[model samples]
Target: MKILCGSAGWTDKTLIACKRFYPADCRTAEARLRFYASQFPLVEVDSSYYGMPSAANSALWVDRTPADFTFDIKAFRLLTGHQTVRESLPKDIAMAIPETGKKNLYYRDVPAEVLDELWRSYREALEPLRNAGKLGAVLFQFAPWLMCGPKGNAHVEECADRMQEYTVAVEFRNESWLNDRHAFDTLELLRRRKLVHVIIDAPETVTNRAHTLWQVTNPELAFVRLHGRDAEKWNATGAPTAAGRFDYDYSDNELAQISGPIRDVSRRTAKTHVIFNNCREDQGQRNARTLMKILGR
Candidate 1:
């Protein structure tokens, strides 16, 4: 299942051809979804960012996406350490969990019990997609604070453990984890756990490392995210979310480099999914169209 093309589902102002995923395009949510589905066979929903969608929303998504199309959803922020909260107790109890309002390995501190509850609850949300055969990989884009080391490896182990418990593909952030110089223990760990690595494509900069997410040998589902090649923005702030510098596009050379990696991984796999997050404007979308045209997908 090599994914020739795909775009991040966000209601951006930039208009793109082929198709558009309205992740938060709730302005005309259903219509946006339908519109995109009409043009593309797949969509990567950012719904997990805001936490699992309600049952009604899930039902709506199931009803909207055609049987042949697909939806790749990232894991919720809560499940990962991208967000933090007090792990509030029930309305009746008022005070039970941590008052420090701890996070998780990515952010605030959280009790194991809270994490267990959160993971189980969110896992349930994917049931509809699973049942419909539309469930894509669960990308767990861990927070930047999750710097790699002994601690990072521990986090990886924990995440892998959870994914195995749930039986899903996963993705990772933090350059340390992707560094080729680093040991392959982590990569092997993912392989053993049967977790899919989320290959990242961003400009080579101090903040961005050249990482290949093809650890999962099968490549049944290759996940690639083009975070844009804004080297200056990344190098200057050491942050990927600095300002939007939509001044560059994937040159032939750059795309050539990427196509190789995709081909390398896909050569042995069944399917691949390439997403363009350089979507500050229509950069990612444009690249996707170009790749589609070039690859004749």
Candidate 2:
């Protein structure tokens, strides 16, 4: 089985502060990336979800990492239909849009021209990685409110069509997308579109726990993202941010329980990517390394 194990992102402040994985000389971005590439073959670009990435930076990344290293980039906030701040948009995009004194803009609010520009820029930014054969996939994780229905399906199809040149992975945060009645059909939809279904392990007590379903939808590439089971903070409205929400470490037994399923999925697919999203400290990295040891990868 072709299994790639990694953490969601390498730049977490907690990972740096822990001073466990990186050497002191690995301080700058290039040094850190070089060191990280030495340790892991894959990494997910979580920062790209917060802001648009530059082509120059992407090219620099290709130069810094080894040829075998691969990157899975998160889709930009706007592309995934999240509530993005008006100020977060690029200057050209902001100027092109008609401002109605709104503080935030949803994917629906953006004009067609602005959306096209944003999509074009995102694809262009990834060209360097793609050319170097370091680009694994572009992950499109939809918001919790994006339920299963005609509208939701349309949006998913539109995203797939726009990025048809690249491999796309789809992750749904909403429970409605996967239930007893909808699970098979939803998986079939992703299969038909050639979208890699993102399997996740998160707190099961949350209102949106339906996303915990672990079925494989695409045979080309399967993904498993382990977000530690922190039930208390999973849906805590008082929590400051996602950093707090996903703050938990997996025990040996918990990780052991997942090992079988991961191996099973990897055996059936061309490649399987297992990423840890529990980035509270070095917790995600630690758990990911532990899993790698368990799988003997």
Candidate 3:
């Protein structure tokens, strides 16, 4: 089994501001990516979730990283039924939308043609990475309101159909998806669609948060995201940034405890990707390195 450990994204503001992970000379974007690639074999593209990615940028990413390095891109907010800013859409697409009074865009608000265009553009943007064998998976992280019901299931199926050509991974934020009543059916649904189940390590104190389940829905790959155990901030209202929401570091003991389950999941799948999402001041990078060492990778 192959195990790849990495952070959610390489370019977090706090991660850079800390001045601990990167060398002093590595200041530019190119230099930072090259330096990060030298340390970790994989990375998750978190920025892509906020807005559409350009093909040119993806091509540049292909050039900067090592041949074996892989990138798991987070699905765009619009694609995953989240409330997206109107400006986040491509300028052309934004202009095309019939001037609704609303400032935000949701999946239900778009016309079929516009939806098709958005999906096409998103897939095209990642072509460079896919062609180069560096695209790991397109992660579809559903919103907390997306419950375990017919509507949510249909949406998941739609997303899977849209990205049928690529490796798809599903991360459910709502607890209902894996609750005592729906856990079996949810896993079965993912298994039927061949969607890689994304195991989350988050603050379990929140009632809405999904429980951490170690099962693998797709035998091809398994994904794990550690969001730290900061229960207080997990559901804190009016947080300034995601870093503030996911702000906790893993101790050596914590990493060692999770390493065993990660290894077990890796054994079941052909490959496993473990990503740290704690973006406070190089915590993810430091924790990822520690986990890698513990796993003897």
Candidate 4:
């Protein structure tokens, strides 16, 4: 089994400021990526969720990393039906919006043409990485409000169709998608579409939206994201940033419990990506390294 381990983002501010993961010389973006690539085989690009990535940067990443290094980029917030701040979008995309005064816009609020443009822009941005064989999967992590049903399922198909050129991974924040009754059905949906099911390690509570389960829908690639078991902040609506919500760190026993499932998934899939998403300071980076050692990778 080809198993790769890494953290969500290498360029996270806390990971750099914490001064525990990267060396002092890894100050520049290029240097940081190069160093990170040397240590880990894969990385998840979380910044793309905030703003569309650039082709130039993607190309640079290819040049900076090792030949086997891979990047899994998150879908743009607007593309995933999340409430995106208009200002964070590209100038042209933002200007095209009818309600310029509004602070945020949902995926449904955007016009068809504008949404198509956004998709085009994202595809183009990732082309460089794809061409270089540095791209793993484009993650479409839908918002918690995007529930399970025919409508939600159709949207998933639409996203898959839009990115047909690349491998797509789907992560649902809505627990309804993975409830006891719908879990197997949802897995079948992903299997039929050849979409990588993003198995999550989050708070094991119904209200948390994300369910902590061991499921592998895609035999080609099993992608696991560990967001830690921070139940207190799992549904904390008032949290200002992602770090606040994913604040917990895994203890030794916690990692041991997850290790078994990861190994089981690895045996079934051609490749497995174990990504630690607890992006609070150096917690994720440390845990990723720890998990790697635990898994004997």
* lDDT (C-alpha, whole model) for all candidates: 0.64, 0.88, 0.93, 0.87
Best by TM-score: 3
Q: What is the C-alpha RMSD of each candidate to the true structure, in Å?
A: 4.3, 1.1, 0.9, 1.5
Q: Write the per-residue lDDT of candidate 4 for residues 35-107, one digit (tens) a residue.
A: 8899899999999999889998898988999888999999999889888888788899888878846678988
The collision pairs in model 4 are none
- Candidates 3 and 4 compared by TM-score, better number: 3
> Which residue segments of model 1 deviate by more than 4 Å?
13-27, 85-96, 101-108, 165-167, 208-210, 213-216, 235-248, 251-253
Regarding lDDT, does 2 or 4 come out ahead? 2
List candidate 2 stretches off by more than 4 Å: none
RMSD of 2: 1.1
Clashing pairs in 2: none
Where's the lowest-lDDT run of ten residues in candidate 2?
209-218
How many backbone overlaps does candidate 1 show?
11
What's the distance in Å from true for residue 256, model 2?
1.4
Candidate 3 lDDT over residue span 24-131, tens digit each: 999999999999999999999999999998899999999999999999999999999999888899998887778678878889989899999999999999999999
lDDT at residue 260 of model 1 (Cα atoms): 72
For residue 199, what is the lDDT in candidate 2? 91
TM-score of each: 0.80, 0.97, 0.98, 0.96
RMSD of candidate 3 to the true fold? 0.9
